[model samples]
Target chain A: MKYLTYILRNARRNPARTGLTIASIAISMFLMMILTSFFAAMQEANSASRQYNRIIVMNANGFAGVVPIARVRQIAAMDGVVAATPFAWYGGKYQNQRVLFAQFGVDADSVFDTLEEFHLPDDQLAAFKADKAGAVVGPKLAREYGLKIGDAMPLQGDVYPVDLKLNIHGIYESPRNSDQRMVLFHHDYLDDQLRLLGPSSSSGSSATQPSGRAGNAGIVFVRCKDAAATAALCKKVDDEYRSTDNPTRTQTEEAFGQMFSEMMGGMKDMVFWIGCAVVVSLLFVAGNAMAMAMRERTMEIAVLKAIGFGKGLVLTLVLVEAVLVAGLGGALGTLGSKALFDLFDVSPYTGGFLPFFYVPWRVALAGLGVSLFVGFVSGVVPAVMAAGSSVVDGLRKVV
Target chain B: MSAPPSIELRGVEKEYRRDEFVVPVLQGLDLSVADGEYLALMGPSGSGKTTLLNLVAGLDVATRGQVIVHGQDLGRLSEGQITRWRADNVGFIFQTYNLVPVLTAAENVELPLLLTKLSRKRRRENVATALRVVGLEGRERHYPRQLSGGQEQRVAIARAIATDPFLLVADEPTGDLDRGTADEILELLEQLNREFEKTIVMVTHDPLAARRAGRILHLDKGRLVDDVINDSAAAAG
Candidate 1:
């Protein structure tokens, strides 16, 4: 406690060098946290999916292929299945701008059952089920676009032959951020338009095309009766469809989330290595600054020893000052990163992957730990050298 | 019964190893100082004056002989024990007034007392008393850079005496000061010796500075060439 003033004074001895070193560490740590946050987002997604025993049943070709809508009924009647719904992606444009929030043609009545986390009032849910054109927007999407219950949400088709004129009937709130950023309407309404406008009518793909993607579901979401039965049910569904024309692959919701992470697994490693490179670069920056600061204090250190300060005390003070500088920078970086994600909605920039990009306390703590480690590494050599140096030579060097 | 000398060196030989070669600085140097004695060392450059002072102050080890200060054999003590002994018994004043530039005068004075078990209030009181004794009562908050050359040396003296060590070893204590400031510093040293009875060993090149000491020893080529007793200087002090 008595030595704190001396240590802090020494840390602030050269304001320019200390500020530069701190800035270097802060920038490096911010970049590292940004990269780590990507993986944290994926983990958060999987963690949310694991809360319920849900399985995603997609066609063999994944999103490129569509499953027959009749399979939802067949899966719902399966032994361990509790509820099932057809979930299809609608690539649409709104107000001549690309829709940032996801638009999906979901079975409105059963989607509320499958995604039980989304909270909609009983009246709002009934209103959505009564009208085919009624749509429910997630709270996050409503907040982003200032959408109200009676707002006319018109979506121009990008992937289908017909457009949708949907009226927002409900906005769902969920504890999970990702689940509350989607727009879901009755699949029957979209199917009615798809059948009316054949493949060649509006999209002008081909005039003689006999078949279209009508009455097809992009994916089937199944809620199992028990969590432990999901793996077995996924295998049963995939094996049963293996020999059929419309083959399918079924996976637990968490596993489905992991599939996207696996797609980005190699990139995560690259980003991690880049973060490592950033830390290494900061090590040198901090090391050089510490070396210079220690060198400047060489004579004062000798004077301290002459006045009876032990080598151990000197070493501790030097290392502690280094850590103090680094810890301040780390704390600043965390605040900066948190403020950025908090003050602005990065949903528009994350490609809908991370709508709520708040940095977890664990990741912030990890960054601070890394800062302390860098401090210890960078200060050890110079501190040991300073403490172990000959006092006579040091005093005489300046004398 | 007579007490032992405050400092005694019996055939102390000090050498430095530079790579493989051995450079001898002090050879078979035998010296002793009675309690409360004021002595000064004078010599040309590379004459072992400062080396002998270092040996007596326990800053360096004797290569082949015994250096006993305050009745403890420094050569037999470990590094830790010698440091504690130095802190308890000896005070040092450097030629360059080596107070930490960042610390104020009071903080600099309080530095040595930090080694003791003294409470913070007591340490502050001791620092104030030390600074007061040096005639710098109101300058406690001034940094080394803020003070003049002589004031800085006075603050260094206050720091040296803050723990109330009985002995003070100063190497060229006034080397960087002007003659007026040097005289002021020398007078302060004489007052400390006459009033407080501190055993002071000083190394100086100025003849005028040496005259302020009760005794002066001249060294040349690693040997004590002459030891002079300045009775008038003792009387003057």
Candidate 2:
């Protein structure tokens, strides 16, 4: 404890240099925490999808193409299937073009059963099942548009020409952040509207016509009776569509979520690489600062050695100083990042993919681990140099 | 019947290498200092006086021969063992008053005691005693820069004797002070020698400072040339 005062005072010898080094470390660690949080959010979405025991079967041509609704019944009757729901993307603007949120057309009767994470009251669930134009909105979407049960919400469609007027049948909540920014309506309503617009309204040549036929759906979501059977069920579904006009591409919910996340220009890998670059840059900055400090304290180190401090003790002192600097920076950076994330909503940055983006505890811990690693790497070279120099020669130095 | 010599250098030789040349600093120098003896080494520039002091203090090793101080051959001990031995047996004073600038007077004095297993209270008591012995009892809180030349040297002296070592080695202890401050420091050294019975080996070029010691030795070109006993100065003391 007595010696700690000396080490701290020595660090303050050049206040400007020490302050700059600490600031650089803090900023780099802040960047590292942000990158780590982004990856964690993506992984969180993937894990949430896995927990639901859901699988997505889309057209092999891609999500733009369609799957037959008849496949939903076949999937539900499959050996490992529990329930199935058909889903289609409705890129709608609420009241104006600026207010954008995820709006999906789903088979409302089986949606709650397939996605057990979405929770609504018993009466509201019955009300949604009974009304033809009823919609279930997420709590966040409901709060954003001042919606309540039985409130009428209108959406202007950009992809399709028909405008949708829906009654808010229920407001559901989920533990997962990604699930709380969406609105789900009956897929039959979308089909009716598209049919009213005629067959020419289908923009893509590959897009299937909404003809109220048994074989017509944008995508099918199947819930497996056992999550471990997801792989086998995916293979079975793919085989069943092999000879059909539009063959299917089937995957577990986790893989489907990962694929969508990757579709955003491989951002998960980019964030990981950016994190690596931040660590490397921090290592260099910290190493240079420690080296310069050791050089300036050469004479003092010799004085300590002469006064009977062994090489091990000297090395420990140097390492302790380095760790102290890095630890302080790590604490500030992590706490600062936490505050920034808590104050701002960064969901727009993720393009509505990760609706709930915040720094997780594990990411904070990893950021601290990186800081300590930087400290260790930076301290090694300078600590060895200081401890290895000849005491006589060191004392002979004027400084 | 008398105690053995406190320091013994038998045929000590030291050499330094400059790229390709082997520059000899001390060659076959034999010297001894008895217990409680106050001795000084006086020489011209580059006469190997400081080198011999370093050898005696166990700060450097002899190229050949044995430097047996307090009956332990320093050359045989590893560098780490030598450092521990120095901490336990030898106290050092430098010409520049090598006090760690960042530490206060008491903190600097407390440095050598840190290596010991002494408790904080005991170390503080020892530091206070050492500072009082050098007559800077109330100035313990002052930094090195806050003290004058004489006071800084006194703090250095306090630090050198903080562990109560058997041997005290000083290299030009008053080289960078005015005459008044220098004489005050020399008087302090004389007082420590007479009162505490410390075995002092100082290296200095100042004749007056040399006269303060019981015996003085002169070195020229890595060899001792004179051994003068200061009986008159001793009588004055």
Candidate 3:
């Protein structure tokens, strides 16, 4: 404890150098924290999709192609399948085209059966079933847009060309916070509105609507009785549609989420590599700073050694100084990132991709671990040099 | 019959190697200092006076022969053990007054005691007594750069003796000071030797500083050629 003050004072010997080193470390650590948090959020989203015994059936051509709604009945009647629901991407905007959220047009009758994680009240479900133009919003989305039950929510569709005016029937809660950012309504209401707009209406433009049918869906979500049987069931469903005119691609919900993440051009791996680069750069920066400090203190180190301080003690003193700087920078970067995320809503920025973008405890702990690693790596060379110096020769050094 | 010598050097040889060249510093030198003896080593440049002091203080190892201090053979002890021995037994004063610039006088004086298991309050008391002994009681809060050359040397001396070691080794203790300040420092060393009964081996080229010592030895070519006793100065003091 007595020596700690001496170490700290020595670190402050060159205030400008120390300050710049700390700032560099802080910036790199902040970048690392953000990257790690982003990767963690992606993993959380993928993991959330894995918890349910569900499979996603999309067009073999990929997510851009529409799946026929008539396939939902065949999928539900397949072996090991409990129920299936057709979910169409509305890509709707609220008030303006910029206010976007995850608004999906789903089969209202089979949604709860397919997605048991969403907890909606029985009365609210009955009201949504009774009203053709009824929508159920997640609690997070409701709080974000200041929505309440019984309010009419108007959405401007970007992809479908139909403007929707639906009543907010209920706000559902889920175990995962990311799951509570969705707005789901009946696909039947969308098809009925499109048919009323006539084939010549702008709302019924051929570019916006799927050809050959008014009831086509973007994808079908199939629920299975056993999660372990998902791979075989997916194969069976894909095989059933393989001989048809429009083949289907069937996969587990987790795989579907993974494919979406991959469609973003390997963003998760890019983030991981960026995190690695930041850590390496930080190591070099901190190491150079410590080496410079050691060079300046050569005589002082010899003085300490001549005064009977052990090599281990001198080494520890230097290492403690390095760790103090790194730990302070790490704490600032990580806690600062948390505060920044909490102050702003980033879900809208992600375009509803990452519903939960906050830093998790694991990512924060990993950031701190990286900081400690940087400190250790930075201090090792200088600490060894200080400890291994010859006292007689060191005393002869003028500076 | 008397107590064993405070420090003993037997045929100690020291050599420095630069690449393939082995440059000899001290060759087959033998010397001893009795307890409470004030000894001075005088020589020209490169006479191996500082080298001998370093060997006695356990800062450097002898190339051959034994450096036994306070009844323990330093050459036989490992590097770590010698370091521990030096902490417990030897104090050093440098000509440059190598006080850690970042620390205050009190902190500098308190540095050696940090190696001990002493409490903070006990260490503070020791630093206070050391500073007072050097007549810098109120200057304890001043940094080395803020102090005069004489004052910085006094703080360095205080740091050397703060741990109450068995022997004090000084290398050109007043070489960097003016005549007046050098005399003051020599007087302080005299007081420490007389009052505290500290065995001191000092190296210097200053003849006046050598006169203050009880005995002086002159070295030439790594071997002692002359030994003189200052009887008149001892009687006068």
Candidate 4:
């Protein structure tokens, strides 16, 4: 009890240093929490969208572009391809806003049937089917465009030369996959638009030729009978398309997600380096604060030591004071970071890639653990110096 | 067992080496203090009065001889054992009061009792009794900073007697106080000596304070030069 009082009194004596130390700890913890939460949220979204039983076949050259719809059909006819859908890449700009988003033209029925994540209401589904030029936008994109159920959106395609007039048939939202903001239109609309804008059969060029179907569909989604059959099915599909004009690369849904994540190499490296630097800098700040506090309280520590307080007791007193300050700071920082997320919207506009900023529990727990460890590490040297001081010398010290 | 001599020093010597020189503080000094004796040591600055007092109080070590207090040789004990012996057998009153500034008078008085196996209620009772003995029961909650110099010294006295030790060792207990406060402290010490029968060995430079003791021992350098018993004290009815 005496030791506790002594610790509290000492902690109270230097309010400025203690407050600064706590602030440093809080900020570091908050940053760590934010970074970890951001990454973990991305992983959860990826995991939610990734269908393990499905196989995604892309260009063998490994890049984002169009593959022929004929190629998609061939891959669909392969064995173990219970269902397959052609998904074309449409990088579109809305109303010249300079904000880029994903747009995919799929066989809407087959897409809704094969990919379970594209869940929409029956009315919205019917609306999408009734209108040939109709499109469905993710909830975030719909909100950004201020589009209602019947709003007509003029979207400019980045790769194709056609400007599309798409009616907003429905708004799609998924807590996990809701981050994928895209406009999905009917594949027939794109195919007809291309035919209308191209040379006709009277010119001795078939409009339905492979060259005319160049941008028909760049990707195909194939679902195997079961998860265990996906690997063999992927190899079989790749082997079947290996001799075709447009060869294919097949991978499981998870591997495709990992490939997308690996695309942002620069951002991932920046996150790693920034995290390391922040933690190291915080440790230095915390260490300095503890050292200064210990130096200023030398006389008080000496007095306690002189009056029959054991060395261990004195050390514990100082360390407990540090831990109290740091732990309180960490808890406040975590809570404050959460509150900050609520009060201020800091979601990065990284080309519509992420949504819903948060602080993960693992990150919070790790931050707290680091704060405690820093408190102990920083206080140890100073506590030892105070405790090991000679009683006679301590008594002689004026301050 | 018989009543212990409270403090005993036999051929005790203290020496300090300065660079290449060996300086002796106490040279082969021998003394015995009775159970309830009130003794004072006085001499010049370089005299061994403080050194001898420290030896008797078990606060310092002897280079060549035994410092026995209440039948235990202080030289043979470990640091922890010596601290325990000091807490058990001797109390100290310093010139500076040495009260922890953060603690109240009552808490300061309760410090020595921490070394004892007394319960909290019993400790509180004993602290109250000690404060009453020093006439500071009314100011029990006053901090050291809140009290006057004289009041702080009285609190120090309360702390010294809190554990009911066999002996009290004071080094210039009145050195920092004014004449009136010094006289009050002296009266308190005399009362303790008379009423409680606590043997006291006080080191002082004040001749008047020295004159109040039952015996005054004068020293030059490190050896005792004069030892005299006060005739009035001996003849007191």
Residue range B1-237, candidate 2, lDDT tens digits: 978788888998999999999999988888888888899999998889888988988889899988998899999999989999999988888888889888999999999999999999999999999999999989999999999989999999999999999889998899999999999999999988889989899999999899999999999999889888889768966
The model with the greater DockQ, 1 or 4, is 1
CA RMSD, predictions in order: 2.3, 3.0, 3.4, 5.2
Per-residue accuracy of model 3 over B1-237 as CA lDDT, tens digit each = 878888899999999999999989899888888888889999987888888888989999999999999889999998899899889988889899999998999999999999999999999999999999999989989999999999999999999999998799998899999999999999999998989999999999999999989989998888888888879557755
lDDT of each: 0.86, 0.85, 0.85, 0.75
Task: Find the candidate with the highest lDDT and give its number.
Answer: 1
Q: Can you list the residue pairs that collide in candidate 4?
A: A67-A218
For model 1, the stretches where C-alpha displacement exceeds 4 angstroms are A199-211, A351-353
- DockQ of every model listed? 0.65, 0.59, 0.56, 0.21
Give fnat, all candidates. 0.49, 0.68, 0.64, 0.02
Expressed as tens digits, the lDDT of each residue in A319-368 for candidate 2 is: 88888788778877877787788777666556565567778777887788
B135-229 per-residue lDDT for model 4 (tens digits) = 99789889899999999999988988898987888878889889899989988998889899889899898987876788899999999888888
Tell me the tens digit of each residue's lDDT in model 3 across A1-399: 888879888888898988988888777777777777876777776777776889999889877566777888888888898889998877778887564578888888899888888878999999988888999998878988899989999998676667889999999877654667788999888877666766555435443453323567888999998888799999998898898766889999988877766776577778788888888888899899999999988888898898898999999999999888887788778777777886776776676667777777778777877888888889999999999999988987421
lDDT per residue (tens digit) for residues B27-64 in model 1: 88888899999999999999998788777877778899
Q: Give the range where candidate 1 chain A is weakest over 10 consecutive residues by summed lDDT.
A: A202-211
By TM-score, the candidates rank as: 1, 2, 3, 4
Chain A TM-score vs. truth, each candidate: 0.94, 0.88, 0.89, 0.84
Better of 2 and 4 by lDDT: 2
For candidate 4, lDDT tens digit of each residue in A1-399? Answer: 644655665666667877877887887778777766676656666676555478888878765434567666676676776777888765667888654567878877666666766678889988998888998887766766577889998878655656678898988765533444678888878777666666543234332342365455777887766787789978887787788766778898777777777777677788878877876776677767877887766655654554455577677877787777777788888777766775654443665555456665556667777777777777787778877876544544331
What TM-score does prediction 2 earn? 0.91
The true-versus-predicted C-alpha distance at residue A25 of model 3, in Å, is: 1.5
- Which stretches of candidate 3 lie above 4 Å from their native place? A70-84, A109-127, A138-151, A174-181, A197-213, A222-243, A351-353, B19-21, B136-149, B178-184
